[model samples]
Target: MALIAFRRRSPLPPAEAWRRVTDWPRHSAHVPLTRLSTEPPGPTRTGTVVLARTGRGRLGFDDPMEVVRWEPPGPDGTGRCRLVKRGGVVVGWAEIEVRPDGAGSVVSWREEARVRLLPRLFDPPTAWAGRRIFGRVVDTLLAAPPRSAGGPGRPDGPGRGARRRGT
Candidate 1:
């Protein structure tokens, strides 16, 4: 598997980012080409997150995904996520995590892709693309600030479990 990671700090508080990441259904609102479905077989934590993404013309159509392992690190928490599926085979994976910074927080994402159709000789290209895609996603999240936590009329400060997930 090829590994790629990107780190970025968000302006929003930990609570805001936690809520946004756990609520997968609403993710498409912030992320482009990413349609995440929260409801699926099994518990939401380890449950499957289906994504329909249309890639290049060569990819043929919207790429279907079977996602699992989702988490938002707490004040003292650690987390990771991964994915797999390519045509009739499984060849994709990702591990994302977040940790508390001094005032805000930092997110680190590691991803890997292995396509069977392509010979092993193309592993370098796959790794390069993974880095680019993961970088863009992290950048987008940093640019879009999160909504205030708590609820309407009543804003919340930080929660009890806000911890650091980056180096």
Candidate 2:
């Protein structure tokens, strides 16, 4: 199995960081040729299934993952979510954690994956690529937008859309 793990620190608060990291559909925006769908079509919890379909037309594959554990951040508390991949083409598990830092928060991701029919010799490269791709996704998700000149917003800062408009 290919194993990938990494950590990132962000200026956003723990709850905000958890929210950003756990936003399932947003993942499709970051990954190429991928679309996300959740079962039960609402707030996620244990047993929620997140499906990611990738590829073009009939060439696509599904990476269906079921939430095995879910915990949102509490006031001054850490949050954690774990998912188990249950697709014909992919199998493994992933865990995401968000915790309060000095004034912001730190997020960590760890994943183990195995592609059907792939030899174990390629695990190293697969893990490397997974790290690069998922790391970028995490970075993009955690990055905070530039604050407006003097406008007041959340204590952490303005939303990503607002920061983009300022530029």
Candidate 3:
């Protein structure tokens, strides 16, 4: 079981941040590779799981996820969100929280995903990419949530991603 955690600071409040996360599918445009399905979904909360695809054609690894748990921070200011795998054995989890610091919010992400027996093929690169991806995600979120639309926002599209080390 490999583990990687990323913590980011957001200019948005806990409530607003929570709203956006729980509403991932609608905001799928902001993420790198994700596809929303037409099937009816459930409310956004602890134990509520949502189904979605990934990569170019996600239909191949058809699996849904369970939200598991959700904790809202107090007025002093700090909230947390946790999620776990649902049906399939390919377990993947992501946790993001916000702590109000002065004016801006401190966002944190902790994720540990397992691809079962396919470890040999998707380990190193996955770890390497996770770190960079998290940073890019943070940068994108810092830019005032594009008001014209509602969804996750990225610095740029696929072709214009942050220049990698060697590139």
Top-TM-score structure, candidate number:
2
Ranking by lDDT: 2, 3, 1
Q: What are the models' TM-scores?
A: 0.63, 0.85, 0.71
- Tens-place lDDT per residue, model 1, 53-147, is 54434653344455566665655744455555543433676666666666666666666666666787888886777666545445544544344
Whole-model lDDT values for every prediction: 0.53, 0.80, 0.57
Q: Number of the top candidate by lDDT? A: 2
lDDT of 3 by residue, 44-96 (tens): 66766666566675335544766667777677677787877553646777787
Where model 1 places Cα greater than 4 Å from the true spot, the runs are 20-43, 55-68, 77-79, 84-90, 147-167
Q: What RMSD, rounded to one decimal, does every model reach? A: 7.0, 7.1, 5.2
lDDT of 2: 0.80
Encode model 2's per-residue lDDT on 100-152: one tens digit a residue.
Answer: 87888888889999988699998999899898777777777677453336432
Worst 10 residues of 2 by lDDT: 158-167
Q: After superposition, how far is residue 114 of candidate 3 from its true place, in Å?
A: 1.3
TM-score-wise, the better of 2 and 3 is 2
TM-score of 2: 0.85
126: Cα error in model 3, Å: 1.5
- In candidate 2, how many Å is residue 6 off? 0.2
Q: After superposition, how far is residue 3 of candidate 1 from its true place, in Å?
A: 2.0
